[model samples]
Target: MNRTPEDRIVELGLVLPDVVSPAGSFQPSVKSGPYVYTSGQLPIVNGKLVMTGKLGQTVTTQQAAELAAICALNALAAVRAEVRELSRVRRIVKVVGFVTSVPDYSDQPAVVNGAGDLLTEIFGRAGTHARSAIGVVALPRNAPVELELIAEIAD
Candidate 1:
């Protein structure tokens, strides 16, 4: 029996959170042709941020990494909202992560691995994708991390 992405998520002991409503004029995700582009997703749970602070200041690398994973969950929620099913995703094409941190910090990749690792666990090889981890001055809601995902979908 073939397992679907939703099944894989359950097997990995995770659940997709409710999609965060767009706070701006943009849609949470837009599907064009065979791809879905998502807006940046924050580490929110139950309609609130999990934490707020700069990564190298009040937040530790580990904490930021965990938050990155949460952002991935929110990203998945956005994809589901667009495609109507997790299994519709053929593969994750790319992930762009932004971390709010003090100027001197330079461990962005380690923080982003949290999301990549979880994605792999949930989607297997399909989760693997190109990624960029960027350090920024700040993000919306003062979130420690934010992530945007691009996925190729099936018809």
Candidate 2:
């Protein structure tokens, strides 16, 4: 039998990686009213940061896009943990994604679509949300992608 979303998460081997550790001493996530907001999550595996540098430079756009998706997945893990269950996720709300890009790169938004696309695939309609794709010089830990999430949960 196929795994449900929760089981698929486990099958995909996601372990949440200890909530990314509050790089500048801010909480990884905060609950305000019925929403849980997550800080940026980098593509990390086995407690070590993976995929670094500017897109279209040290990293290809395709690679950066994939990293961006993983970052969103991690963010989802954080949100699900906070809301206590995936079932509480009423809507994705918004996703703010940041990409490390070279000065001339104008495909930042396309790269971030990797995250948005995955969210839709996983959560179906609930994953559709307001979004922002930001381009920056660098991200924490020099990661190629960093993503933040805002999710509305059940009462």
Candidate 3:
């Protein structure tokens, strides 16, 4: 708990990539009062999706999970851009993950754990939050996974 979330990210050797530009009219993140909400983030690096295709089709659960982690990092980047620092986050309030999957793929929660686990590692107890994992047939840019986060800012 002594280590800050930013410090934990560096200790974990994970770099938050640059925030990707929103593909549409919406902002990447919006801060209102004590909370910051990030738009859906894809598993993109340097402006390109890491992988495409549905789970149980061309992507495996593990791969999707990794991609979901990348989405989490991207979400953090968006949050940082809005709030100016991860240290300002008091806790992660909510997370919603979407996975493009084959009809029979019923392990959406497992994939979303990729994001949740990383957040837990970086923020410790504060990372725990209410979450929803959804399965869909498609996503923007054909990303295998996408996630959004709601973070409460410290006063």
Supply the global lDDT for candidate 3.
0.94
Q: Per-residue lDDT tens digits of candidate 2, residues 18-51?
A: 4555558777678899999998888876678777
lDDT of 3 by residue, 55-107 (tens): 99999999998999999999999999988889889999999999999999999
lDDT of each: 0.94, 0.80, 0.94
In terms of lDDT, which candidate is stronger, 2 or 3?
3
Cα-based lDDT at residue 128, candidate 3: 96
**How many clashes in each structure?**
0, 0, 0
| Candidate 1: residue 86 lDDT (0-100) | 91
Off by over 4 Å in 1: none
